[model samples]
Target chain A: MAPMRIDQLTPGTVAHIVAIDLDELGERRLREHGLDEGVEVELLHRAAFGADPLAVRVGNACVAMRRSQAAGVTVRVAQRLEAAE
Target chain B: MSEVMTAPVVALVGNPNAGKTSLFNALTGARQKVANYPGVTVERKAGTLTLPDGSRAELIDLPGAHSLEPRSPDEEVTRDVLVGAYAHERVPDAIIAVVDATNLASQLRFVLELKALGRPMVVALNMMDLAERDGFFIDYEALARELALPVIPTVAVRRRGLEAVIAAARDALNAAEISAIRSADAPAMLVEAIGDMRGHQRQARDIAAKVVSGGDANQMTRQIDRLVLHPVSGPVLLAVILFLMFQAVFAWATPFADAIEGAIGWAQGIVMTSLPAGPVRGFLTEGLLGGVGAVIVFLPQIVILFAFILVLEQSGYMTRAAFLMDRLMAGVGLSGRAFIPLLSSFACAIPGIMATRSIADPKDRLTTILIAPLMTCSARLPVYAVIIAAFIPDRTVGGLANMQGLVLFGLYAFGVVGALAAAWVLRLTVTKGAGGGFLMEMPKYQLPAIRDLAIGIWQRAWAFLRRAGTIILVSTMVLWVFASYPKAPDGVSQVDYSIAGRIGAGLEVVFAPIGFNKEISIALVPGMAAREVAVAALGTVYAIDADDEELLEVELADRLRGAWPLPTALAFLAWFVFAPQCISTFAVTRRETNGWRWPIFMFSYLFVMAYLGAGATYWISKWALGG
Candidate 1:
């Protein structure tokens, strides 16, 4: 219903980027890797340690970034895929 | 047309993992030249390509970049070359913009950015096989018309569509004069595109939405990542992979290393009997064979290590490994990017130091380079082996591990701990700045091609061998001259009378506080050439006349046991664990950092660590053992 940080999205949840709050450089880098407003993304995986870094599927590509970087991106949930488990 | 003319330059540009390098390798096969761009450590990889017309074009592989907006030094090079701003590199007469055919929507964003420059360009829709396998179909004709550039589907790894791609490139070059006139209005195109990435993305998405239909790609990658990045299984698999790689680096490479050593020894033996026993013979056996040979012996290990690194990188597992190690390395203020370079340091710091180029943040790369030598490289192995054999007893400790083996393991552990500690401190001080963030793309995994692996390993091994031939060769010869000159008087030992001996005698005073003897002091001089040479220098200083290799080790070990106390032996091991003794490492650091500044700082800090580490070891052992 509301925009959430990509880091806060549950695994298997699909979302579209609403806006990026990172510094100019970070935002530019994220956009260059196909992360931009209205682009569909899915939360795919989180690293083992503390889950600080996350892997998000941007378009057809997978991007790994720390939570700090991912927190800058605000996204609106589109749908939650059924968990196989 | 028949007249001879300079080859037109065609540059291959792409985003990372777009198969640009594989295409370059396939087209230029074995004609590649990799060198550093002038005034920067970024590599310049160029090769000659034969056009379908039997004419040649210089195909330069520009460093992969996401956009022309310069974020890193590598990106700056790519952007500069594309915009005709880099002074050292020629402007490409035609550009081949490589994009992944599987995910054209995202990759076309970069191709759209490249089109703004208006260079006569062809679009290489690479990885077409994967796209087809994943159930994607594209109207290449429509895509070509939409972009106003020739779009050629290519499977670069299989050398598919190469001739057509080259023929298109030749046609683009033929149309370059007209394109140049068209580019008259495209001035400062990069500046405008930098601020309008959203526009490019929208246009690229529009183009893809108009002409492409496909099922979900990268499904296989997602499935594998499920297990490979699982909370429990991910780290375990990473650990297993790393352990196996290290094992392969050491165990699998041992016989090849032994063969190389045997060949050098055989060469030395021939020189020994063929030449008269004089300066000429001494120089050949000691300087040329011993100095260069010792460094060359590590080639097998480097090749093995690189074979693993190249595979992991090509298979896209390297990024995953970096992702797994990120949080742990973050404890030391380094991103996970430092993990591969630091791991490589165990084989040899040269490649490890060079590998730091992957790190985008300057401070993070600097910190990694400074701590790389503390990883207890394979050169330190022979020194540790000799010292551990001489002092540590053969008896078992804890009823399972041999005492010597335990000590050897401890030395490795010590080096790793010391490296982490140094990194921690350096991050707080010299390399302190904005902390680097871990932001990487995890590409779909594919089997590494055997040809690419061979080329990668060959390039690294050749760089190492070149160092051995130049810097290592020179330093060894200088040390040999110092060690051999002014033969001893009738009674005095040759080493005691030589220039190196006198320097050792003088250095002994400075080293005495750390419990180093005159023989150790003398060996330290030649050790600057390489760590392992210290062992051979010690043998000569001890005046053990054993010609056979096994006899030398046995007699030298016994002699060391009788001559030095246990504390000194332990101290020797401690010094090597931190000492900056390799000149080749310094040379590479200078080349990497582009000056003497960082290498000087590295040398100074490491010397201090070695002094403190050795002194502490000597005193603690002496007091603990009542020696």
Candidate 2:
């Protein structure tokens, strides 16, 4: 259960969205973007540059978020997995 | 079907932070115009896509909204456009609802609402990469069956899944089942059903379990945030970043600005040598070259300024800075929502005013609009550069930072102060009700795409050049005519009897109390078009008959210091801080507010403040100097 930075999340990993430790503005933005409790997300890819903005698949769409804000979002690794073919 | 006859209109809608912009940019390529301003999109941006059949499909990116219920003006606009409530435009033929793949439950709520609208609709599941990393699996088929819409996974930044999105849109459009919802049955049952369904959140969970897969948290971000977000370190980091921004503006832009100046000088030399000594030569040299070149020389500074802003915005640090300033902004009657728009005002006020639509409270929005222009914009950069270069001694402060850069930072600080003070006063007098409460979202930080960042910067630079070429061009020509006409008597200086000089002299009677000379008065008149135009106008007016290649900065300073006192120089700078001068800003204010009353009040109040502020600065400077 090592606490990992959001940017290191790779595609195909499943984690629960724990919490978004952001300012009021950032908090509202997180809610607006559908990053809340009970929601599971998958890391799609890091943007090309070394910057922290990443694309994550939430529900039926992929959205980008900054690494700093994502760091505040705590998540537990999902246990369920598809059997290797 | 005669598919080639008419283009299909495809509307893009999504909750904020749903990667709609990335998707739009991916689809439209270089055809985006940033309809309103940075950080906020209000108007519909239309771009055409050539279908395989040679029929064109028009793609329209609508403003991001949380719900179709429409809480704010921006949301209402989205609702109206979707509902075909707009007076001029027809309803879109197809809807592309972009949803964050990781945050499906809430986003699906909006999709369900859109489904109820009965329009041909498809869901673009953007940010699939992030979803996989977070270990969320989405069963597109199950979700599609549940919502009864085509679902496509997309990584907009990577330009992935766009084809599927387009194909789904095409399929939806061709199907005749897409029609407006006209059920006479009350929506109360649907609302109740939705409320009840929330209890079975497992519906979304079950679908997600079926489709999405593989997301593991990375350890690096956690380790870094511990140090960066530390209360003491966070502010320090922000300060360091800002210091670098100003330093870059001066240090990096000097050589480029000098190159442009040299080029303009070479062109001016050619015009003087080739053209006969007549009105045409004077017009080319003084009016066109002097006026335009003076403004263009500052282009490097403009580009560099945007470079810093764009990088910061893309890095995701800007939102953090705004978050830090939220408490402070609230003390001055501004909501957290005002931060983005006000930050944008530093580049231009038109878009800043338009960005106010995001503020739900009319009073807060109006107050934000009124004070936005007080923020120092790119247009004010030339004037500040000229004045600072002329007056402020260029020495290092604390043996580390350049004194000139600090002064430039101070000028920006002064504008922020002026905006806050105005907002405070307006809250008490003009605007009614309490300021809107803060509710903002903080998106997870991810690396910014270099291509998108580059495109954003280029767009800003293009806009700056367009303004310089058109509005500044015609105004400079007219200024030349005014300052060139009414030839002086045999012995009198040519400018002394010219139309501009006479007008300035008459106006000086009023401005003299604040220590401004006739020339300064004349220049201030055209400053209303834009602040930087005043610098160009001054160059043209003073260089009307000059022959030497001496630096314009040194010459202008010498002339001003000889004709007017130091108090006047200081007073003029103070006036700019609160000046109700930019006519274009006022026009934008009128458009944003949809009335003349707000603009009129803003203008009159700002004029009084500018006069009083300048008058005060003059007296203080005079006393300090013992003049």
Candidate 3:
């Protein structure tokens, strides 16, 4: 499957992180939070009204990140149970 | 062995919301005082822990960082202290790397990076209870074996498995070669070693996968997230929470405020009855009892205000709040992390500015600090109250909300709008830099720990009293001297010939454009001390009777109504919305920014804004009313 930016995922979409193209510092911070390749990320939802920053679940932690930041992260879509496998 | 060190130092490092601070409080108990890292505003928190064998270890809680690489001044301080490069802080004899057990894969990377430094260290797998509740069956022993270091499982909030961690720390401190990691050469070498974090991440994942963990996703957290992160309901919920918090600060705290007011009044009555009528009496009854006591009266409101912030923060709601505010703030080029600091500024700008130290990006922190004083703090309540009381009628609208209340609400809204506009301008002009997109770790939702909340409130309340006693008291006395001196030139109401009156008369020329007369010009000098002081200042200048402190607000409002024109009164209200901030706010800005540049800039900008805003309001109101 073609990898898409994580920000493209809608609520209920679970994707496996393929790559992160952010700055070194930001990429390192994401890696420290278990957003490395093959880690499963579930797009939670966007914030109310503005809907700019998106929330996602990664490794039992809920992360709130800007859409611009999420765009730097590439992911392959998968079912939640499939990603668990 | 390099040497046996006295008073062994241990650095506790971790990622944000990793339970590092919770473990520190549990380990240190009550013996902790936060001071500044020399020449900077970032806090240096150290506490003493007595080992079972009577040996003492000083534990320093380092600010959370992503890795050994430093990004901003705040993170640089942490990295420098770790590498012994910080000139003021000693490199620790041992390092305690606290990691959250629930998400081992994410936290283990920082552990691996810190391990490369070759420090005598132990890993505290904190929040073990939460991990277990989430069905994360972590083989901490296997993880320990993989790192070849002691891994102690701990529940920081509950203090579970605390003894094992303490035992490990003591052993690491007492072991040989404490100086190995303390050497200057190790940091540069280690930085190079950890440069390839992709390799480290791979290794960390391998170990985490092998720790024989049967992972069970938390159903409770997932369910809660569904509600809190709902597109429609999320922001609505946030607004409701914030509204309740502000409303409670006023409603829930009134009884306590009244009690405090009654107590101070009683004490003042006793003193006034006994003392002879002279300058000593005036100083005691008015300056100390009335002026300083006025600031202290807001303690109940302050306490209630911070209680909400502390609970929201510790309960994991603040991160959610940040997420909610991100898009709104991102329009102005600010990250989500600036949310809490700006929120706290509504109570007082001092802590709000200090809270920015946790933001690792210096530009974001600076931007947040610059806009903090515009949040309309509790100290501005009195000025607003006196104005609204004097001008706005006390009728009910829709039989629920008072006319006066709706006006007050409009004023609050105006202050907030002004703050947002100011922040946007500041970010675009000065202090503009590469904007970092918001990314924050969302900690699991949990009930706030009572002990931690109690300690937090106690510390803030104490600081409030201390500041009231020193700075507020001194400024009050200075105001009194300015009002009472020069003997009234033997006939002119003890003020017309005084230094303060003369200065106010001369300053009226500059202030006249904003519709301020001599009395208001006089009040402005003392209002620089604090926003609330302007009320009492104007009250005294107008020669209101001083028999009862309780009647002061009422008397002042009537005196103001009979004296000033309605347009001039409206102008004064506009002035306070963007008033040139209290001296203490500027003082805090100086400390937080570590320079005079930002403080001077802040004062000048706010002064100009207040002057223009007041003038516009006065002329507009006059036109509308056909005055």
Candidate 4:
């Protein structure tokens, strides 16, 4: 299976970022927040309305970013952690 | 170091949630000075810190920046000041890079970047308590040895290791080789990594791996996020918190507001009875007391509102609220960051406009400032109250809600709708630019410290009071002169004979089509000073005795009902919903935007809205009511 964009990962799935493709500013913002190649990311929650912005845990900080921005980040799935736990 | 006589300067730099502010407060207590940087609106916060040796040093808290590379205006200020490129602030003798221990891997990236600057610096590992609570022990000594710097573990809120941190910073500043150290060239790799975010991040993680021992995940934050970020419960809880905040602003603040109002009234009474009737009495009672007192009465509401805002921000729930509201705000081309500022505008637009500094995107901040006055601030309450009391019947409609209450709610709803519409139009028009992204960190929730919260509230309250004393005070005195002199020839009614009266008569021609009479036109003049003063202005225009405020309200409502038609009263309410009536708001808009162009545009647009809205209300109501 191909590596998926971060926004498509399941809520509890762990992934390693493979590539980030955004405009200069957007890419810089993501990198400054410690989201880069080989960094671990976990999809945690989606906002209620449309779920366009996903709350993902990167390193020890939880970041809120829109799906459009999240779509630029390609990640290889690591494992699916149980959401209930 | 350059100035041998002056106090040594120490700058505290960190990421946004690294407890830098809390540490600053702990270090400096109440001795702090806040001012804007020379050419920008970013705040320059400096305080006097007494070091362990009892000598003082100037501690400045630079704005939080993710890296040395600038992304926003705030980050630009940080980078400029740190590199000694900003003309106003000198380069600091020593730097304290505050890093959150719980999130060391990411935060240390900033520290490493600061280290690359080759400045005399120490690492203050903050939030150590939170790290330990999450089952992690950071070897600070090993980390210090690895990085070749002093690392002090600290819990800022608890004031742990603060002295040690200060002592280390003092030692760094006092070292004779500090200047020599800075002059030495940085390593090639470190210089190359300054602009490379990934390189610094990777280097930070390698250091973190060496010193961090264990990590049982922070289950507390995860469990709370599960509920707080829930699709259904999240917004529901947000709604509940908002409801409580508004309730507190209105309900809990009434008694204090009344006390303040009563005190001012008593002072006016004392001036009236003790002195013979003359210009002195009028100046004291009417100009000073009536004008400034009205604006000051809203201070309690402002304080209460700010208390809730500070608590929400410090507790880390503001970002969560912003996350929930981001979509709704985006519908009008704004990010969730606009939510807090817009919410603050409900209390007053001055602080609301000031709060926009946190919104990194310039276009988004300007748009938010432009629509802030449309939030139906507490200042509009007095005008709305008087108008609703006079026009809307005091009875329940549909057996569930009061008729008067419904009309007030409708007016509030109308203002909100208007603001949203204005924002939508603005984004497409002048403010159109690169759409800003919503990239914010959701920090782990922490209990807000009482001392820090109190200090924040006090600073805001002081700013509000200072504005009241300066701009509001001057405008009221000027209005008093315009309304008082050229006293009426006996029986002519003083307000009609005054200069303000003639100006009102002149303005009546333009306002006539909107169903406003001469008194309404006259009141609109002083109403520009503040929205609530319109009520008092109307009292003056009608020649009513303003002895007792309670009786004045009753007498004013009764008089208004007798003088104006139903359509006229309703039209007046509609006019206030969009009018840019407060001078202080306009002044603040100019200051925040750093120019007159945006404030001018804001005034012109709002005036157009008020005119069209009032005219429409009058014509439709006249046709329906057969007036």
Q: What is the TM-score, restricted to chain A, for candidate 3?
A: 0.85
Candidate 4 per-residue lDDT, tens place, B80-106, comes to 777767889877878999998988888
Better of 2 and 4 by DockQ: 4
Candidate 4: residue B366 Cα off by (Å)? 3.4
Question: What TM-score, to 2 decimals, does candidate 2 have?
Answer: 0.83
Error of 2 at B523 (Å): 0.8
Those runs of model 2 whose alpha carbons end farther than 4 Å from true positions after fitting are A1-85, B1-4, B33-41, B176-229, B545-564
Per residue, candidate 1 scores C-alpha lDDT tens digits across B80-120 of 88877788987788999999887788889899888888788
DockQ of 2: 0.10
Report, for every candidate in turn, its global Cα lDDT versus the true structure. 0.83, 0.73, 0.81, 0.83
Per-residue lDDT of B216-242 in model 2, one digit per residue for the tens?
Answer: 443333344444444557557877887
Task: Please give me the DockQ of candidate 4 compared with the native complex.
Answer: 0.75
What DockQ number belongs to candidate 1? 0.76
Query: What are the chain A TM-scores of the candidates, in order?
Result: 0.90, 0.81, 0.85, 0.89
Better of 2 and 3 by DockQ: 3
Off by more than 4 A, model 1:
A80-85, B1-4, B177-187, B344-358, B376-413, B529-569, B584-597, B621-626
Residue pairs clashing in model 4 are none
Of the two candidates 3 and 4, the one with more favorable lDDT, higher being better, is 4
* DockQ for every prediction shown: 0.76, 0.10, 0.70, 0.75
Off by more than 4 A, model 4: A79-85, B1-4, B176-193, B378-412, B526-570, B582-595, B619-626
